[model samples]
Target: MAKKLEYKDLLAAGVHFGHLKRKWNPKMAPYIFMEKNGIHLIDINKTLVALDEAAKAMKGVVRSNKKVLFVATKKQAREIVEQVAKRTGMPYVTERWLGGMLTNFSTIRKSIKKLNSLEKLMKSESYENLTKRERLMMERKKEKMEKVLGGILEMNRLPGALFIVDIHREHIALAEAKRLGIPVFAMVDTDSDPTSVDYPIPANDDAYKSIELIVNYIGDVIEEAQQERKQEKEAQKLQAEENKKRAMDEGADLENAPESHDEEE
Candidate 1:
């Protein structure tokens, strides 16, 4: 069994540290423990509870076979989140968060389709026959699109949930998710409003250790759920095959059995 998150673990990761008291948002008072040296200390107990809640919710989302889009554009969180997202096989946005990423998904799909076609063209013989200048233009266009759309290249539909690093910095992403009625899970600091997200894990979003600890835990939960979903599909397939084989055997038995004749006086 995997190890559960402990209060000491969170403490070591600096998850209990929050922003300056003056910069704190009043809406996050419930999760604030107290002020020390002008910095608000997040309630470790509350943080643990919130983390558990968010993990459970995300597990359900992944188990349902729906994607969870990970968004972390901050310097401290981008690489950590990208690695976790890739390991979990989920779509992620470590680059700029386009305004209509979730709200106006149709346009994004068009861009993705174009990127696909461009890639195909580049691989075809016709691409080489083009002039040097034309080739350079196509390459630059492809590069620009890839930088923004690479993480979501395989995402063909809206995600079931969005996991964000900082709600304050990624407000646009949060807004787009809310506009589309998508659930959001995020690490909300003292400077941000926790109520803005569906599942808020209060922690020091700026710390590399803090972000890594929480994000890795969530990734593990998703991986476990994915494994369970795969097992369920395999089990269902096996049961179906067994039922079909049984029916076939029963039919064969009936066909080989001698037919009963009515007795005559």
Candidate 2:
């Protein structure tokens, strides 16, 4: 079972902190607990609810053996997003959000293919036969591609879901996801519109502590589900082996005993 998120954790991470009063969005009124001085405070209860719902959905995706792409291109979130996503073995985008990343997935895949081919060429002996200038050019290209597409190299298909850090700033990514009919899980600050995402965890999207805490919880859930799925497959394999052994034993007994009875009769 996934760990239940407590209000204390959220509070400690300053997840309840929201944008300045003047920048608040009306749609976020329901999630806003109250205004503190000049800033808005998010409702802790609502944050927990939204988080649990999103976590459950993400777990479902992992159990089904599907990927959830994590997007956090903002300065405060880039490193944290990459670390967490890497720990969970999930694809992530911490650099610029490429337009049509989801909608133009076919072209993106072709690029991934090219990147892979480049890798293979680098690993092959023929690569050593290239001129020094040509090799230097190839190396630079590979490094650039690796920085952006490395996390997603294994992701041949479109992700089952998206977990975005800042929905407003990553709007292009959100739009592409929506266009592809992929569900979105996002960290929605008071200034952002929650309605755009399928699962919106309202909190301080800009804070490093807030994003780290929430992302860590999610990463834990994904890893747990992945472990469970592996156990299930192992159990099924064991059951099949046992059934096969029993059938073989029964056939051997019949063949060894039944012929004698027929001869006596």
Candidate 3:
């Protein structure tokens, strides 16, 4: 398991910082420790507790061999989320979240299929036979589609859960997940509604450092779970091989022991 998150680490990352006091959501009062100057200070203890719960939930989803789609379109969090998703081999939406991405999944899949066909066509010898203008148009389309959907190419089905940076900003993604009954895990800022998500980790969602620390921790949980799943599969395969070998050995022994069976006759 990865090292447990410490209060000092979260402090150093400015995870306790929240929106201005006036902008604070009443629903997040439990997570607000106090007001510092004009801003709300998030409760570090509650942050830790919420983070642990979210981590466990994400671990369970990944260990089941299901995808957890990462959504972070804001400038500060986009790259960080993309890197974590790539490293974990999970799907992500860093550029933009298309409407009906989860609710109308079949249509989105068709678009992905079209992108794939375009790629294959571009790689074939016949691609060169096309006029230059035609090739250019196709190339532009490919680039646009890749920018939007490249991160989710491997996601052939709906994700088991969602890990989002700012739930307020990614409300559309959250709504889609909810519509599909997919669990959502998100960083809920003081201005956001914690009750909207299934797993809400109350923290400073706007700070790059804060988002990075929390998102990285979640990524570690996913990676650890994936490793455990891999180990379990290997062990099961080895056990099955041993059982097959033992059964074959028993069959050989039985074949050789048949000579004494007629002695009673």
Q: lDDT for every model?
A: 0.94, 0.92, 0.93
Q: List TM-scores for all candidates, in order.
A: 0.94, 0.91, 0.95
Ranking by lDDT: 1, 3, 2
Model 3 lDDT tens row, 150-198: 9999999999999989999999999989888899999999999999999
| Candidate 2 Cα RMSD after full superposition onto the native fold (Å) | 2.6
Global CA lDDT of candidate 1, please?
Answer: 0.94
lDDT of 2 by residue, 97-204 (tens): 778788888988998999999999999999999999999999999999888888788888999999999898999999989988899999999999999999999989
Q: Candidate 2 regions off by >4 Å?
A: 129-131, 253-265
Q: Better model by TM-score, 1 or 2?
A: 1
Candidate 3 local distance difference test against the native:
0.93
Q: Which pairs clash in model 1?
A: none
